[model samples]
Target chain A: MMVAEAQINNNTINLLEGWEEGLDKAPEWVQSFRKKAADDVMKTGLPTPAWEDWKYTNLRNLESVTLCEASSLHVVPNISSPFIDLKPIIVQLFNGSFVGEMPDLPDGLMIAPINEVWTNDWFKGFVSSLSIDTPMEALNSAFLNDGIVIKVSENTKIAEPLLLLSTYENSKDMLSVMPRIVIILENNAELNIVEHQSGIGSYVCNQATSINLGEKSKLGHYILQDNDRTQGYLFNTTKLNCYDDAVYDGFSLNHGAKLSRHEIFADLLGERIECIINGAYNLISTQHHDTTIKTGHFSPNSISKQIYKGVINHEASAVFQGRICVHNDAQGTDGHQLNRTLLLSEKAEFNAKPELKIYADDVKCSHGVTSGDLNDEELFYLRSRGIPEIEAKQILTKAFVAEVIEGIKDSVVRDIFLSISIEEGTK
Target chain B: MRAQLGRKKESNYKMIKIKDLHASIDGKEVLKGLSLEIPKGEVHAIMGPNGSGKSTLSYVLSGKEGYEITSGSISFDGHDVTNMMPEERAALGMFLAFQYPVEIPGVTTINFLRTAINSLRKARGEEEMDAISFLKLQKARTAELGVTMDMLKRGLNVGFSGGEKKRNEVLQLVMLEPRFAVLDETDSGLDIDALKVVSKGINSLRSAERSFLVITHYQRLLDYIKPDVVHVLADGVIQKTGGAELALELEKHGYAEFEKNQSNGAVA
Candidate 1:
C-alpha cells in the first residue's frame, strides 16, 4: 500500500478515493495506459498561467475540486437535440457509461462500447498508441472506462448525421467523468458526427475524441456544449489524423460551462489534404473559456485554415491560442489562422496568440490576432440613424463576427449557429 | 441679373430658431453667440471661408460628436431640441448629409437604409415596411440618380469613390425624407455631372412642409438648386444677408472683403 501510494501522486490518489470506488472493468492493455498516464501526472502537474502554452489561463481547482472516477452509473434520462432532427441514429451514455441499447444504424455502420469492439487490431493499436501530455488529458486516459466506438465501413456515405449525447446526472453532489470517443472512417467513407453534452450536477466532465480518417474519407464534426454551467466544469480534447485526400471540417458553438477548455490537434499526414477548424465562444458573467489549437502539415499539398471569434462581457475573460507548423518536405502547404475578440465591458478581458513555424521556403503560412471593444464611430453612425443604443450594438457586434457563421456550408448547422449568439452581450 | 433679397420678413411659420448660440469643439470656441431663423419650406444657404464655424453649425444642429453647445436654444418645429440625442433628433425629422460619409464594413447600404427607416417607423408606432415595398420604393428613388445595383449591394461607403459617396449621402437624404435637412458641403467633391445628379435628388425631395439648410463655400451648387436666402457667416455671426445673387457676388469678389472687414472690426 505504501509503495502504491508512493508510485502515484497525492492528486491522483485523491482522484481515486471518491464515488466509493475507481476504474473497474477496463482490460489489461487499457490498464497499462491508465497507469502510465497517472505516473506522468505525478511527474509534471497541472497547468498554470506561467506555462508558455497556458500563458493566459489557469487551472485553479485541479487539486481542490472533489473529483472521483465515475465507477457506477445510474439511469439514462431522455434528451433530444435542438438542431438537425432528421430521425438520425442516436447513442446515449449516462455518467461516462454506455447505458442504453443503440438505435438502428445505417448499413456498414456499427456502434458499441469500447470493451465490446477492442478485438480489431486497428482499434487496439489506436487506443494503446495514445500518449497523454497534459493533466486533464492524463486524467481522461487514467480513469477512462466507458465511451462509444463508431466504425464506418469503407466506401459508405451516411446521408443523415449521427447524434451522440453524453448526459451526466446522479444523486451525488459531486462527480468526475472521463468519456472517451473513438471514430474510425474507412477508405472513402463519409459521415457527419454531432456530439453534445448536457447535465444538472456538479460534475467535472473530461471528454476526449480521436478520429482516424482513411484515404479519401470526409468527416464533418460538430460539438454542442450547452450544459448547466453554473454548477459544472467541462474539458474537451479532439485529435485528428487525416490520410490522403481526406477532409476534416469541425465547428463548435460554446455557450455554457463554468470553466471550459477545448483543445484541438490535427495532423495532415497525406498529400492533397485539407482541414478547416472554426468555432465561436460567448463568455458571460465571470465565465472563463479557452480554446487552444495546434495543427501540423507533414505532407505536400495540404491546406489548413483556423478562424475563431469570441465575445466576452460582464467580468468574463477568454483566451485563444492557434499554432501551425509546417515541415521541410511540406513544400506546397498553405496554412492560415485568425482570432478576433470583442470586449464588451471594462472588466472583460481577452487574449490571443497566433504562432506560425515554417521551415520550407515554398510554403505560404500567416496568422493574425486582434482584440478590441466596439468601434465608437460605427456605434455613433448606427445610433444616429435612429437605431436604439441596444440594437445598434447588437447589429455591430453581430456583423463583426457573422463571417464565422457564414463560413459554415451546411444550412441547418448555420441556422443553429445563428440561434446561439452568446447574448448580444450586455455591458 | 436679379435683384438681391435679404432674410424673409420675420414670420410666425418658423422651422428652426436658434437664439444666443455659443458652441465649442475640443475646448476651442467656434460658434459665439450666433443666431438664425429659417422659415418653413425655405432653402437657406450659409457661405463662409475656412474655419468660420460653418461646419460646426451644421454639426451642432445635427447632434454630432465632439461639439458642445455651452449656451444655446435650438427649437425645431415646436420642440426644444438642444438636449435631444442624435437618434432622437433623427426621429423628429432632422437629417445631416455628411461631407465625409463614414465607411462601415460588413453593412450593406440596402440593409442600412432598411434599418434606419424601420427604426424611425417603430418610434412612431408604424409598421415596418416589407422587403417587396422597400425594394420598390428604393428603385423609384435611385432610378434617376444613376446609382447602380452594385453600389447598393456593397458595404456602406466602403470602396466608393468620392462622388459616389456624396451621391450615396443624397440617396439617404431622399429615403429618410426628413423635415429639416442640413447638407454640409455636399458639393465639395462632386464633378459637374455628379453635382447635377445630387442636386436633382435633393431637389426632388423639396416640398412645402420640408426645409433645408445648405452650407457651401462656392456658389456653383446654388446655380443648380437655387436657395431662398443666402447669409455670409464670418466671426461666427451673419455679417451679410441677401438673395441667391449674394452667392454670385461672393464668387466674383471672393471672401477677401469679408475677412478684411472682420479684421478691421477686431482692431477697432
Candidate 2:
C-alpha cells in the first residue's frame, strides 16, 4: 500500500509540473481551472488497485506516462463523413478547445461553453451538485476549460439531436487532452445528445460529461468512441441526475483505442424515474476496454435496467462491472442487470462482475453474468445445414452482438453500428 | 460466368451403399454391422423397434459427433465419405432431416438457407445466386412446404412446434436439392395432417437423380411415401431384408424373435 501511495504521488507531481508548463497557450478561464485541478490531483493521487471499482482495470501504466500539452492544433482535420446530415446544434472541440464553426441555432436549444455560465448563480449551484469524490471527476472540474453546455427550454422538444464531436489530431509529442462537458434539460423537455470521440494518432484523452434532467424530462444519450490504433489512453466519466418521472436512456459502443475506460454514475433522486443503460464493446488484438456503471436509487418507486455485452477476439481483454444500490429509504425500487461475454480465442479474456446491493426490504433487484463460447449443438446444426465452420462462427457472433445493437432507436446509426460490428466479428 | 460441368458418371451410379457397418456412441455399440444399399431412383424405408440404431445409422453416415465407426465403410457416389465433416458431407449433397432439430436463436431461416445454398453452389464451381433470385426461389419452396413467410422470418426452429420443425426440415431439403437424403425418424412426432404435408413435400422431390433412406418406427408414413424395399434394423444389424410387406410383419409381430436371435448369437 505504501508503494502504491508513493507511485501515485510521483505521478501527481509529474502531471502538475506538466500542467504548469502547458497552460501558457490555453484560455484564461482554462488556466485557472488547471491550477485548481493540479491542486486536487495532488490531494487525491492515483486510485489503488484495492479500490472496488478499479479492481478489474489497472491504471499503473497510464499513471507513469509524462503526458505533454496539445501541439497539433495547426494541423488540418479531415472532417468528411459526419454521422448525421441534419443541421444540428453542432459543437466541435479540437483537442479540448472549442472550434469556430457553429451550426444554425434551433428554437429552444442553447449551446455554449460551460465557462460562459460558470459565474451564473443558478448554474453554479447546479455544478456544485456534481459528485467530486473521485479523483478523475475532481481533476476534470479543476481543469474545466471549453466544453459544450446544452440547455433545453421547459416544455420544448428538439427533433434533431445535439451533436458534440471531440477530435484529437496527431501531436508531435506525447500529449493528453482533458475535455469536460455539462448538459441540462429543463422540466418536461425532451432531447437527444450524441458524443463522438475520434483521433488520428497516439494521444491520451480524459473526458468528463455531466447531465442533469429536470422533473418529467426525457433524455437519450449515445457515446461512440472509435479512435485509431495509435491512440493510447482514454478515461471517460459520465454522471446523471434524475428527477420525478424523468427518463434517461444511454447506450455506449466502443470499437478502438489501445486502452479505454468508461465510468457512469446515475443518481435517481425522485420517485418513479426510469433509466435504461445498454452498451456493447468489440475488442481485438492487445486492446483493453473497461466499462463500469453504478446506479443509486435514492428515492422510492424508481426503476433501472442495464444490459452490457462484449465480444473479445485475438489477445484483447474486456471488463464489465455493474452495481446497483437501493438505499434503506428507497423502498419499492425495481432493478435488473445482465452482463454477457463471448470469448473468441483461447488467449482472449473477459471479466464480468455484476452486483446488486439492496438495503430496502421491499425492493426487487437481481443481477446475473455469463461467459462462454458458442454452443456446440448449435454449431453442428448449422454445419449440418451446409454452413461452413468459419461462417457459422461469424453468424453466431453477429447474433450475439445484435442483442445490444437492437436497442438503438436511430436506424442510420443502428445500420452503421451493425455493419462495423459484423466486419469486426468476421475479422 | 462458368458453365455447368458435365454430370460425372458417378452421379448416375447408386449414390449411397452401406455394407456391414458397425458403430457406437458413448462406448455403447449401436450399429452391429448393419448393411443396406440405397440405389439411385429408389427410396428405401428402414422400420425398427425402439433403440434399434436407426438414428445411429443416419448420424454415422452424416458424420455426427460421439458416434464412432467400429468397422465397415459408407460409400457415397463412388467416394469413401465415412470420415468427413458435417459441412463437407453437406457440400457433397448429403442431407439429413433430424428427428429433433436444434434451435439456432437469432439466425433467420432465409439467411441460413441462402448461406447454405450459396456454399454448395460455390463448391460446385457454379455462379452464386443473387438476392432477388434467391428470395424468389425461397418463396416458392416455402409455399410448397405450406410454411408461411412469417415462419421463415423468425429464428431457425425458435418457438416452432413439432410439426412446424419437421416441415422446416423438408423446406431445406427442397431448397438444397441434395442427391441423397437420410430422414432420421422424420415421422415420429407428426399427426396425420402434418405427416401428409411432410410426405407430400418429400414425394415431390423424388427423381432418378436423388435417393432417400427413410428411418421410421411406424409403418404409417411408409404407406404414404411408398418404399421400394423395407429392412428391419434390430440389435444394430439388419435382422430381416424383404419386400414392403416386411414393415407390416414387424408392425404386427414386433421384434421379439429378432431380439432373441441376437441375444442367442451373442452368447455363442
Q: What C-alpha lDDT do the candidate models reach, one value each?
A: 0.80, 0.79
Candidate 1 global CA lDDT score: 0.80
Instruction: For model 2 chain A, give the 10-residue run with minimal summed lDDT.
Output: A1-10
lDDT of 1 at A120: 66
> Which stretch of 10 consecutive residues in model 1 chain B shows the poorest summed lDDT?
B1-10
- lDDT score for residue B80 of model 2: 84
- Relative to the true structure, candidate 1 has a C-alpha RMSD (angstroms) of 5.1
lDDT: worst 10-residue window of model 1 chain A: A1-10
Error of 1 at B181 (Å): 2.2
Q: Per-candidate TM vs. native?
A: 0.85, 0.89
What's the lDDT for residue B235 in model 1?
70
